[model samples]
Target: MILHTNDVFKVTRPEDIFETRGRFAYFRVELLSQKGNIDVSLKLTGRLDWTFTRSITLTRKTNDKGVAVFPVGRICESLIQGTKSNLITYVITASEYDHAGPALYAVPGFADREILPEWGDGENISQFYPAAPCIVVYPNAGFEQSLFFPKQTGELFVLTPSSTTTEKYIGNSAFSPIIPFDPAKIPSEDLGKPLAVGATPTDYNAEIRTYYDYCTKGIFLKWTDAAGIPYLYRWTQESKTDEMSVESTYHQLDDTLTPRDVQNKTLAKRYTLHSRIVERDVFNLCRTILGCQDLFMYDPDVGNWVRFMVEDSESEDTGAPMQDLVVEIVRYEYL
Candidate 1:
């Protein structure tokens, strides 16, 4: 049997890990004591540069093989990614035991080991790179959430009724009793033009039309107060129509009646918040925003700046004393 040191605590997972999505990433840590696989409570503290430090407690116990295992739950990837230095340092310790160990480092996203500068002789060398947008999510009230787009200024379009195909009857239906109808012998004719009225009984055929709608039912704008608390302001239908024009032709009629024109004809119903917007607190903002099931933000998976909604808050957890907000990517946008 080998003797393990009391200070043999270390993070076993997430080695050199980088998270692109703003979802929770799971990790694990291990601790060893001189007593050989004894049950012990350990504190795991994660520090992200000078911005903030979050710590969670875990109990490590011996398994059937007398080996200790301590698996941590999902950790907010955004909180760990926005560090100034882009490095997250973790330390594990136990009050009753002397198993305080060296700190472990985890890096978020891709980072070059060395950014070598190009050598220039006499002329000034200019390097151009695209700017990445910064996105942040905070609570508006209780569970309601709001997003902050520091670099985004243009209007965002939220699509609805994803289906683009619609059916409309073009032929007149004639009365038919005991008509010898064979499903396999159904006539296939041009459904675009109106069918002529005939005395012989004929079934009314439906013409399928596909189109996309540019008119939005509503708009939710993200705003902040003097205290920097985020809130979502829903735009009225009129306001949405005005903003809709900036992105689409709201009143223009299509000559050919495209699929988009057909979709635009469908109107969306108005939505009302259950609770007064003024009565909501900042913590409950996410709850209210999520309650509006019809609303959808931009996707972030394909762009540098991704929009996320607050899924959970760490302030309520006693173990994690830090005020870290957990957010998941809702939408992605390039610009």
Candidate 2:
């Protein structure tokens, strides 16, 4: 359909990030200066396909800036309205006096600025909101061709991009080990239950594990959908401060044959990472995985996925542009 690019009613919120059309957030639209005080209306769908299959309509007049913002709505109680996909689409529509006109996309529009969670924080995972995975494309320059992780249905697995290129984890989504390993060894919600003893993989994948050294790796947060779209999060550039602690648990034996000392059980390394300084978007992106009860991290030191925690209970945010983050993590998955 032909969209009216020069319409008086416009949406100026979801300024494109990278090459993506808009950020996944609320909808906001502004009226032309000459059209000030005019009524604006919006209809959003609970699906991601951008179709107005569901009917959710609202009307409001423009403010001084010719902009109208939608309230977060009663996410706690609102009945979600339709049974579309997990993702929701906000389609702002407007006309001079609330008369039927083209959709906000027909005009130009933006999304709400704040990355505030539409479904609230990780506080309630069982809530109706679903954190859909998004894909991003990387800039291709001089190098081997880029291959998306979580490859297509029948794509063969390739370990290396090229001889010169190091084994890289392009698709930052959960990965499957190159070679078969104990399912009990893998963590992270990406890989569900452990496989049967002799069962071959009929499902799943992993980040590269071959390339390893004594040195630490950069904290490059990443995510890519099966489509190969990439989303990179470089928080605080790199952490400025780091802290670690260890704890052990074991069973006591009162039997006369047993020794007085309770043998050490396991050493779970708990880490606290303090960022140098970062933007609010980085803060929000970092929180995407906080709701995962089975969240796991790949420990280069041990070359395995270990149970990971963000310590979200104590995390904080103030909405300012520049800020610092205190990330607490725990990594303990070893023999």
TM-score of each: 0.26, 0.31
Candidate 2 residue 195 Cα shift, in angstroms, is 27
Residues 63-175, candidate 2: write the lDDT tens digits. 77787866523320132333322223355666633323322211011222212212122233222112222211112211122222222122223322221133322222122
Question: Among these predicted structures, which one has the highest TM-score?
Answer: 2
Q: What is the alpha-carbon lDDT for the whole of candidate 2?
A: 0.36
What TM-score does prediction 1 earn?
Answer: 0.26
Tens-digit lDDT track of model 1 for 1-335: 01234455433433222222212223333444334455556565666545577666666665444355444323433334454333333444443544444333332322222111221111221110000111112112112332221111112111112111222222211111001111112123321222211122231221111111122333334433221223443323231111111223344456675534222322222222221221112223333343232334322344232233323213232332222222221332221
What's the distance in Å from true for residue 256, model 2? 31
lDDT of each: 0.29, 0.36
lDDT of 1 at 107: 24
Q: After superposition, how far is residue 283 of candidate 2 from its true place, in Å?
A: 17
